[model samples]
Target: MGLFDNAVPGGNITKPLMIALGALLVGKMLSGKSAEQPQEAPAPAPTPAGTTSADGGLLGGLGGLLDKLRDAGHGNVADSWVGTGQNQSINPGDLGSALGPAVIREIAQRTGMNEQELLQQLSTALPGIVDKLTPNGQVPQQHQVASAFNS
Candidate 1:
């Protein structure tokens, strides 16, 4: 008998034929789809005005600020500024409103600098301090006031 005829026991081709057919069927199933067809997935809804993509409104701004605070190792400032007890909570929105007066008082208490001198020095150093905080030369004027106090 030839080598090809004796390759399988009893010269049966049925098993080999079935195996080839099964492989072909599997190949057809896997490769039959066209690449041009678009996949369907659920679309995300639009965000409302004054809202962040992930969360809503002012809370998003506070979340971003908290990240910056952690990076700066000054997270205690947020807790100290907002936590209960002798240190009254100040709204993030009102931080600018309270900054100038607070800076003057803090300077007076810590450095024994008079209010007028503190104000004068702060006013002089304010613009450079602001430039350092911002990417470009511009910082929002409201943010500049608070940043000056922080510096």
Candidate 2:
């Protein structure tokens, strides 16, 4: 459960649900292993400077994830999650395509979910979770996001 275990939000996401997302996009990317098994994995690849937050931790990784979604032709969907207005929905199939097969397979392995179930859960929960994380229509600072997670 790594960093996110101590950082579950009390908003649109539940602890049980979001741990996988956190691990999938943040922990796994940064640490090269599931949050549940940090010690078992090799050292993580280094992130280039400025690719993330000041500390280059979870919030930064989350931002990068949003960028990935945007780059994959889902900017509107990702933007809606961070905007002040209504949240937009994404289809599970579309989400899977955006994430690509390698990521899907990796996350599926880490979370012990099939690709379809994983995409379904993420599509259902991601909008509200992103909306909650971006309460001011902006990505929070690393410290702010960390605090939110811990609260």
RMSD (Cα, Å) for all candidates, in order, is: 32.2, 5.8
Query: Which stretches of candidate 1 lie above 4 Å from their native place?
Result: 1-102, 137-151
Model 1, 40-73: lDDT tens per residue?
Answer: 1123223223334422111123333333334445
Q: Report clash pairs, candidate 2.
A: 7-149
Give the range of the ten consecutive residues with the poorest summed lDDT in model 2: 2-11
Per-residue alpha-carbon lDDT of candidate 2 for residues 43-99, written as tens digits (9 for 90 to 100)? 543433334432334224568668778988999999998998878899999888776
After superposing all C-alphas onto the true structure, candidate 2 shows an RMSD in angstroms of 5.8
Instruction: Tell me the TM-score of model 2.
Output: 0.67
Q: What is the lDDT of candidate 2?
A: 0.62
Best by lDDT: 2
